[model samples]
Target: MKLSHALAALIIAWFAVFGRIQAVTLEVNQGNSTCIKAELTASFSITYNTSNSTRTVQVPLPDSATVDAGSSSCGLDGNTPWLVAVFGPGHALGLSFSTNGSLYSVANLTLQYNLSDTSVFPEANSSDVVTVVSSSVGIWAPINTTYRCLSSATFGVGGVTVTFSNMRLEAYMPGNDLSPAESVCMADQASTTAPPTTTTSATTTVTPAPTPPGTPERGVYSVNNTNGTACLLAQMGLQLNVSYFSQSQNKTIQELVNVTPNLTSSSGSCEASSATLILTEGRATTLTFTFTLNSTSNKYHLSALTLLANWSDMTAPLSASNTSLNYLRSTKGRSYMCNTEQTLAVVPSFSLNTFKLQVQPFEVTTNQFATAEECQMDQDQMLIPIIVGAALAGLVLIVLIAYLIGRKRSHAGYQTI
Candidate 1:
């Protein structure tokens, strides 16, 4: 019985080690300084074929994979930089980086694989090379801070599906490892069940049914002062509307897009009397909000907003600025809440819906959201029904008086009718 138990225990331990997906840590450097250091878990779903059947395979990035950041590794201080990781003989992953002023992000993903490697793809009769490319993965952050997305983000391109999770990366920093206080995580990056696409023959193609989009990406974004006192807190679904010139249509076009958490980089900071939140969409768009505290009123309000959008077709970027808006007013110790679904239009190009939104800015005590002040719009909505009820009561009173007077007149001496 003891020997049998030992065998079983060893079997269980082996499975425990091999069952989990492998994670890899990578670092890219520019000469003596580290440009990017990341630890991520990756999984791939690949489709291949044999003489008589089409089969699918699921593979994880191996633990032996290593990033190449040697003498021929990086673009250094160029406008665009890049890095690569070789997992096997012919399997590799590549990333291209882009910088915009003070921010940088991974702009593209390139994955290459070979079918002749039976270790990755079993029972593959033919040798074929597959390459998958995707753009605008949109993992970005400010310089020196780490970019993180612990939730899984899946990307599908052509016949390949890749899922990356538990990712942490810092780019263009002089330091060796990640920083603690400045790390920013991309919010609401929940993974989706991506279906696989396959091919039966050279000319024919079979595509998987596309998954419906999931819930709107929303997160509790906050900022704290240097001394660790909370100062700004916001929760809302952010959206942007912009008008641009379409070169193909030869006309102007207006479009509305969600400021998705997965594709947008967000950051916040606070001072003694002011706070700001910055959101950027890769290198093409940026939105900023500034809030100020009024000590006399003991309230804080959104004081200014700015937006800059750059598209390749336009000769110049679109810019908009507004000041003294005095929006989202709340006491220093309270937050603003609007339970009803209402959209607050900050400018013609920017708006947000207050669905399950409670926000406080400029002062936060005890590290907790204080009492919530109902929005003025919700207050007005509540008053509408009360006003209608009062009007109906008045009309009923008038009708009752008229009926009583008519009865009294008819009963006088019993013959007036």
Candidate 2:
């Protein structure tokens, strides 16, 4: 028992030393006054190309990062104030702010990274350093109150994306304690421009897939086994619509937030009779899809679904799970396919849409989907086209018979005359 205790202590010490520590606050000074005081937490998703393939890496802002007071400056002449946090060689986090009336917002975020640095990118191959910039983060706060958002918000420029959450920021305030947040970030406050859709022909227009109420992007996700064989595959757009009581804002509200894919923050496990896909959308939301196979029936189905949402308004994150699901069933080797969009109300606080979805949980041979089992929605959609075609055929037959009878009557009338 003594030996075991000593070993446990050593393990604890090792973890303390190796575990990543997150910084709580950052202060930038200009001349004799504090320019900015931000308590921020963010994670970056960067897509970079290596010598052989393209990969995405997620890295959090480390605690060791420090403000660059020498290069940072306060706002002047209607220009925004900016702050820079330098972490390591050739890597930094930069932010610029915008002010309107009594509110202030983050206008731009610039991320500089070095691909050759193994400390930042574990799969570094080349020595190229690049900067990715995102604009209009939509975080706003009143001048008297610090801007705080517990919900995660995502924005991206090209291949670089940032998910900002749990932030408390005050700009141009000196020698004052941070006040409570009265106004938080909301999607309606941000500027959004929809892209124009292209068509194959003048008569053929393709409709884009529907995303969740507040989410913007969708993706296809896959989980592989140890031998590099795919064990589970899914394609869908997800969003979490939930209601919570905000203690700081003193109100109860509902938020519909998008669930974006974080490839670097996801994991999966596969067994002979079961498979699980665990996907994360940032630091705040997690989605778990569990599937099981039944050999006796030669079929597989989604057996359970779990969603965890961490909202700042609540004391603890809400966990919504449904284990009684028998949805998305298919043959053991076939995939469940549905082209129509659907909303799944798993629970009151847990609802999402699986848009343009196709999933195969087990027996994914050749890294491709086999024959598919059409979902109820797809089967129902197929009947609409068939019904329309049959109705048109019947209308044409009636028109032809009417014309023939009119001609026969005219001929009989002429011969009798």
The lDDT for every candidate, in the order shown, is 0.67, 0.69
Best by lDDT: 2
TM-score to native of every candidate shown: 0.43, 0.48
- In candidate 2, residue 410 scores what lDDT? 87
- Candidate 1 residue-wise lDDT at 353: 47
Candidate 2 residues 85-176, lDDT tens each?
A: 87666778888876544445565578888887665555557788888654433455555666666666665543577777777788767454
Pairs that clash in candidate 1: none
**Model 2 weakest 10-residue run by lDDT:** 185-194
Cα-based lDDT at residue 302, candidate 2: 76
How far does residue 154 in candidate 1 sit from its true spot (Å)?
A: 0.7
